[model samples]
Target: MSKPFSQACENNKQPILDKLLVHFRQASRVLEIGSGTGQHAVFFAKNLPHLQWHCSDMPANHAGINQWLADYPSANLHAPVPFTIGQDSWPLELVVDKVDAVFSANTTHIMQRSEVPIMFDLIQKNLPEGGIFCQYGPFNVNGDYTSDSNRDFNQYLISQGCGGLWDIADLQVLVSGLDLLHQYALPANNKLLIWQKC
Candidate 1:
């Protein structure tokens, strides 16, 4: 069976890539969490040849990611890594050197609130000092939805049993001691949370 494609992923890939190119121009290895459809991994690896791209997701998503990455010949793009939020450890056998950056898109709102902190902790463990962690998604600011569209989307997501939009203030509090830095907003209602390990 052919793998499914997400239109939103296609629509947002370029704009996201543009921002990434600016901030991650010097990064060498990027660990991408929740690499759904493998589209972003392939597109980014192709564009940022200097940086090694590591695509990771739950085991079920690996097949589709492998299919998308099969055609890419760059030595920089590593095979998909099986990763899950809250897991005590990763599947990779060797403790490879810490990554330079970690990136995730549209994943935070789908995971439970408690899982978010665990995810950040894992990112902190895997990233080296000064490593960058970038997350993109719709978020609430000061406990209020940024737009009616986001509010509606939050309801829809919660109705489906997934976690809804998160509050920026809440998230900032979670990362308070992690030495993270917030970057400017993205094109969509989504914001990019960028941080570096101090």
Candidate 2:
């Protein structure tokens, strides 16, 4: 089977990497949740050679993720372990030791809405003090969409029985042990939010 691809990933990888360079510079290992097509895993690992990028998604996605890794093959990029936010074990020790940073892109609106807070809870609980979590996706600000396209997209996701978009206000409560550090406005109406364990 051919490796999976995401055009969005191809387009935004570089811009995301630029910000990650600064936020994750001191991070030795990063756990990337919902690794989807594995494009970001390879790209980020190659660019940020200092970081050990470990990918995790549901079991069904592991094969496609491995395909990308085989083609690019970076020492810092490891195979994706099975991970379902509210189901599977955190896989923290399964992939690498000491996860100092966590990254997830375009996942907040894709997974079940109920699981969103769980994701935050796990990240904050597992990360050590000063550890960072960077999440990139289209998020609602104060329960409002930033643009018309995002509003339409949210409708589509709801029509398909997905979680639609997560409101920042709702998520703020879930980040108990984390403190908001930076929120960057990126292209395509997406925001890259960074938080640190406090």
lDDT scores for all predictions? Answer: 0.81, 0.91
Q: Which one wins on lDDT?
A: 2
Per-residue lDDT of 28-129 in model 2, one digit per residue for the tens? 999999999999999999999998999999989999999999999999998998889889767957434979899999998998988888899889878889
Off by over 4 Å in 2: 92-96
Q: RMSD to native for every prediction?
A: 1.7, 1.2
Single out the weakest 10-residue window by summed lDDT for candidate 1.
88-97
Top-scoring candidate (TM-score): 2
Which digits, one per residue and each the tens of the lDDT, describe model 1 over residues 1-198?
587578878878888888789779879888898998888888888899889888888888988888888865567887788888876474453246557888899999998878888888887777777778878889999899988989999999999988889898888788643564765576668888787777
Candidate 1's clash total is 0
After superposition, candidate 1 runs with Cα above 4 Å error: 91-94
